[model samples]
Target chain A: MTDEGPLTPRVTGTVRIVGAGLLGASVGHALRARGADVVLEDASPSQLRLAIDYGAGRAATADDAPTLIVVAVPPDVVADVVERELRAFPDAVVTDVASVKLEPLRELVERGVNLTHYIGSHPLAGRERGGAISARADLFIGRPWVVCRDGKTPASDLALVEALALDLGATPIEMTPEDHDRSVALVSHVPQLVASLLAGQFADAPDGSLRLAGQGVRDTTRIAASAPELWVQILAANAAPVVDILDALSQDLAAVADALRAPEAVGARREVADTIRRGNEGVERLPGKHGQNRRFASLVVMVDDTAGQLGRLFGDLGALAVNVEDFRLEHSPGAPFGLAEIAVAPAVLRDAITGLEERGWKIASTTND
Target chain B: MTDEGPLTPRVTGTVRIVGAGLLGASVGHALRARGADVVLEDASPSQLRLAIDYGAGRAATADDAPTLIVVAVPPDVVADVVERELRAFPDAVVTDVASVKLEPLRELVERGVNLTHYIGSHPLAGRERGGAISARADLFIGRPWVVCRDGKTPASDLALVEALALDLGATPIEMTPEDHDRSVALVSHVPQLVASLLAGQFADAPDGSLRLAGQGVRDTTRIAASAPELWVQILAANAAPVVDILDALSQDLAAVADALRAPEAVGARREVADTIRRGNEGVERLPGKHGQNRRFASLVVMVDDTAGQLGRLFGDLGALAVNVEDFRLEHSPGAPFGLAEIAVAPAVLRDAITGLEERGWKIASTTND
Candidate 1:
């Protein structure tokens, strides 16, 4: 095993993973791939065997003494597992990978667990499915792993958790548990509920109405297909923050509905337009792939729906040495052609359009940044 | 120009396109490409000239008579344009391609305009940007073009409009004006409002909250960037139906908020889970690319983020003679590796896994269909 990247943080001793599900098994796989000692444990014997068989880690034994213990379990059981792990391994730094943070910390506080060696962390990485079989060594690569630390957390313990995140090719962001919960409630939890509710509207829709569904509805509702049982726990665990956001959203929705109901009334059109414009500004505030608010100029290029069309376009882009910041392909059902919307830095937009057009590709339009 | 597909509907004689905007110019281009005479007109001289220069069609002449007239204008101006086109060419079958069908039809009825030669159609196709510059010849190809025809409409006029949709590579589905409006309200208009309102929540979010935005929020709010002015017109034009859907959605959202606010209460968790499960079922009812609800099995293959990794994967799949039904690539920022989720027919899932694994590729997991 080779630990070859500059981002790989070094850990000297054994790192034990509890609850060998997707996140736990993945942490083990990633750590084992980096030539680190890893011990795996799970309440279910079958899951532990599967993780070990998959080369994630070896089975934990009483003789083994771990330096770090990562609690990766469902949100409902996270606090219990963390408490038990901290009690069993007094010398080990205890952390968790649960989606929710504050609830577990409060639980530990209420139970009067020692705070000296516990640091809560959440690696913002996952797959649609769960289990050891779905685990991968690179699951955390380039993802954000948030570490929750308070004034009471020991500096050494926090550093150890951050190192674990770095060793797994993740960027560790320090945040308070309250801040973590609020941030995720806005970005992750609220979006899930919105998608679910929007998709639920489709349940009683006329059959032909759904036949008119296009890419807009599909993209908006894609996450609605997530595991409902799992989401129920995540949402309930962070209910206060999520509810706060949803209540605000409900008020805004009511305002929009009122305006639409009386569109011919004075100021109704302006109200509706103002809400939409705010949405435009809100989306603009979102960071791009590089975690920056920098915008990229995009161009739509028309291409026939042939096998080599996209490959040829990418080849041409390579020949021009123009890096495509992002790409999305749009094809209508039954159309013989599709459009490739490619994003590039503003400086290279003109060059890309000229080069591609000179190479006989039709440039449909250059969209505003 | 070659028309070489089973879906290519044939039409003869001159076709007049009023309003040289995106849809209008695209219709002209598609018809002109099929060796038909197309005349373009717009209130804006500059836009008309641009569309003509872009090979959409030639400028309309006073002496020339058209067999068919297509009114492609904004929702607010659609009725006026359709009425003018009907009077200008009494012998021609007239159709308007506004997104909302019933409003314009109602306006025409209120004015008591001659309805013998008029039909309302809306092609479910568009790019983010508008105007002649964004138009493409294949924009409507493979998309659903809805034609609203009543009992009073002449069969020949309705057939002409359907032929026009088919000739432009679209599938024409006959619906009443009321049905068309209601369907678009549920599928298109309501989704737009939901996305806009959800994104609006970000306007006043805390400074660091949006930094954690993931693909889910991005997908749910993608369409919120649409032009506010244009959407105001569309929402107001179909205000009745859209308001109806929004009202129902608002009620459901309120219920969800109430449940999330008190998750520990009896049945609160069950209510939240039930709502999410209903969303899953709703999404499952949406047809796939080929207009079927057949679910495809998926396999996740790990790949480094080096250039040509996706190309190589496709090449290998081609060599194995396995058809990829759909695919999605997911990567985190600064990650050195990514996962390619490839979908294929259920019958070939095992073979694909074995073939790729033998070729030295890592198959992470096979997702349930």
Candidate 2:
């Protein structure tokens, strides 16, 4: 929810977005699609024309007094761009969308820049690629738009930022700069670093080691494809928080390794179990959809290799109106046999189990009692 | 390759598969697909008919003189069935496809029987559902079929087993039972545990935190949907190896945790970086086919929120006659702008990057160097 009280009028004006890159152009395009006037500016004349030609905005010069100015530039240059815009148009309420918050906020404060109207925001949506030509009006839809509002953020300016997020079809989340940085460090930064480190191991693999690699390792490290330079900057900025999470993960990994080397030691085995158990406990703490905890139920069915059998089973479930949450099969060795584990609602387990057994299906389970 | 000599005359005959469940029926189905004489035997008359109706196999009674007997049964009773088959059809070659070979193999050896004609095999393949009704002939295709051949496996028996893999269109990989268990522990078993641990974290999350999960967490923990009992048995049988890998992971995690708790220490940060970096290195070693590890050379272009820009970009690339491997977009704030990363082959990267830039597009990087 926006910080402003209810019944406050949202400012409706020609929202002008400078830079016309991915975020800039996407904002203009979304605003325009929603029947709002959008004007765009960029230092590159080619980018300016492309934004206009692409229908991202109506072409506008720097002289226009836009009520709101969005500075979408590179991380290294965001502070400079924001300062320049302030000098260029002092009347506008300015904001910047840089990934790291503390650095830019520090830069503005250190320079003694007037801060009453500036807010720091980051829309947590991205892809592996970048640029203005890649911008889409629907890009931010359903994503979190984090507004790092400080004490200096005026009531009017905060509402304008929130309105911009809502206009772009994003969920606006208000967070302190430190909280935002720490959370992202734990979630985004750490994952990237982990992937990069995993990928880096392959740089010195033997001839066939890589070719023989499989899906497990691939899934675990797919995020390694991120840009090196951008990550370097992000990691450098959020180093403190990210390092903390990494330390936790590393300690856990070391203990696991030591336990494997000495399985006979009961102490080590218990530690192994404890770590696994802790991971279990931690995973359970994660939120569910719309912010709720989801309960996952499971069922195991014995199956054979034959046609129409699966169809019949699913058809039977459909007949009984038992909704399967999910299902998995593990093929047993020695002959044509396997086990199928089906997940369903806890409320329906008894009926579903009985329904299958009554139909002559061998449901393999230890009695509940 | 089969164990038989380069030009040994191929011997093919009727093979009877008992049980007709996922594994049993898949054996029959795969053999049948390769034009083998597949005869199926099952206690479940309905399942027998289902297998026949699905064209998995021709029906066979208890008295057939089968060239091979494939006992696809549960681990708990693998010995009983293997011994029963041996007493019934002493001359026929016998094999069991149990996940764990040592226990079943030991059971057979303990029966004081001449096991010269018997071999053990395990094919790693499956889905999240089961039964003869769920069987597919192509289920084992392209999957690793480990043939456990050792001191007890007769030369003739090895040839027969290798021929079986060929008939089923499976890639036969020969490894000592111990090595096979270790490799799977590193690749499959440990991965399952990790995924489950990750998934379990979501069980207790507040509604808000759960809603924040994206595709990253989904893909990373997808294997969590596996059968619990089957995994229990798998991990139990390969406990030593899995424990070894987990121990390694735990050690790394612990070190990381320590670093997180004490970020002010230089050694802590460096150690954390190393662990994260190691994960990145390991990630690159993974193979990519369906989520494989193949690298795509990319061209990043800056674009705006304009109608038809994406279409034109794609059209221009198509016109360049270079295959675009993949594409992603990063939208920025302030302006509706973004950077588009387009993946192509290294061979095509130069042409594509130059071609786009020549057309007056803002490219992120034009050269790899």
Candidate 3:
């Protein structure tokens, strides 16, 4: 089925979602929104009922044969579910949305499952909470959805999975299961561990120290609030790769500690400075908005904490026809004012500033300075 | 001198700023905006002239004997400047805005310089760049301006420093030099090191791994982009406390690495889960906006990439009379749409959602589900 809209991707055939958790329910929602027929299944009857009630999809029946089967279960049971779905739906191309790919693929391979029709995919989008109630139709929109396929997999099967990702407004990236696991370990898993451990240090902090916490600490430790139970499964499933990255990070942390301890020694300060400088280079390597390498110039505009101040600023920008590439609002603790940092294209920076100034909004700094 | 405005703090004497860098220039601008007679001084002639041209203050003269002196110089030279200022203007209540407090106090004590008129303050406000050109008059507004006092400091001197902070629209927080140093070490200094080291890991990551980097990694390493040269000085001056925190962090990292390496071992998974769980509790201890433990409910509103979409949303919010306590905009890597997470008082969440939905905006999820 295809929906008639520029925003909707043309996806055909019936899609079966075999879990009613966050990822599965979200996939079903997105697909159903685009007029694709979706079938929902879950081991828990309540979850299945909730997904259906939430309009993700209708209950699946034995007579229904789907064109594609998406297995969205936990990592520990991904292999088992994928195997069962493949055996049950021999005519359907099967895919699983498990965070870690290599282990499950290995397990399926060891179990002698025919994997020609199976592909492993991971949509790198999630919220803090799970379950069907929290699922949204746009959960995967604009996110990176990794599709893992071996050389033996048929092109038609790969195309079907890619179409699904595209229809859901995600970018489909092709990678081997091994590469996918390693990439996530470096980018996601290791960072989560670092944030958690860093935040863990706060437990022993002196009484008043936390009261002094600022945006720096808040941002650094934000992900530490993630569910421990979910992370345990993710970390354990991708233990080998995650552990390797953690080992490297530990060595670096040790070096930083040594350097800080004896900063007066020759070369110690340089070592500390070098690590921080390398970090600068590393962060710059990450792509900017819209997955592009282009950078935008930022200007800070001052606003009062009063309700309509931000609205007025944005309205002024709209009148000036300045497109804000990005925006961040910074409010100091106990302060009744805020600074809105607006990111705009370099070409429009001067015009945007002059326009805002003409509108009586104070420009703090055209450059971070 | 007093400005005829309710927002202006009542101060009736001349204020002199010694350094024409970001902090120094900002102080001059704020005091001048409040109609205080201000004199600016700087080692760099260009910076001083820039501050003067920016309407921060006039150039300092030998005849200018200000009642209050703010020494806003680099950490390495803060003590020297503070001592010189006290000697130059014996009657002036002297204060220095340096990140580290204990070192400067110690240096003055060792030199036998009486600090009866001197108070150390550090405004917990800064941007990535530093210069007179980047200064903002309202930089310290609503931020914590920590005033470090000792027994020898007279009540009048303490009151003068606090008055300066208040006049500049900052909240004055009093703490002993030792306590202030320790508090900042826990909240700011150590988080900086952790972020830098964590970002350092990305330097050698396999190509394309960073393309998968999400907000979690971005925030965890955001502070790593700060100037290494500046951090080197801050970290060095506060070496002892920062090193202590780093040592503890190192031990934790080692334990996490060990746990991840053998996740299937007895209690290994539990250990991992425990560390992350502790992180949750630690982050929970941090006060939210307004420096209160109260939590705000968040709802995500979807907006298209078209110009004026955000403006329309904000305008709608204003029309509905909803007070947004905090806001965060999340855009996908390659998506043309963005999610605006608006934090509102819990009492108004239902009304806000209903109002926005009535206005035709798509509600992604109310609870980050």
Best by TM-score: 3
**TM-score of candidate 2 relative to the true fold:** 0.65
Q: What lDDT is reached at residue B286 by model 2? A: 61
How many Å off is the CA of B240 in candidate 2? 1.8
Q: Which digits, one per residue and each the tens of the lDDT, describe model 1 over residues B40-92?
A: 99999999999999999998898869888999888999989888888878999
Model 1: CA > 4 A from native: A1-3, A6-9, A299-316, A319-322, A335-340, A346-368, B1-9, B300-309, B336-339, B347-368
Q: Provide the TM-score for each candidate, comma-separated.
A: 0.94, 0.65, 0.96
Q: Rank the candidates by TM-score, best first.
A: 3, 1, 2
Q: For each candidate, C-alpha RMSD in Å?
A: 2.8, 10.5, 2.4
Better of 1 and 3 by TM-score: 3
What value of lDDT does candidate 2 attain over all alpha carbons? 0.66
Which one wins on DockQ?
3
Each model's total of backbone clashes: 3, 137, 3
Q: By the lDDT metric, which is better: model 1 or model 2?
A: 1
- Interface RMSD, all candidates in order, equals 2.8, 11.1, 2.6
- Residue B44 in model 1: shift from native, Å? 1.4
Model 3 clashing residue pairs (backbone): A335-B142, A369-B129, A369-B130
Better of 1 and 3 by DockQ: 3
lDDT string for model 1 (A52-79, tens) is: 9999999998898999999998999998
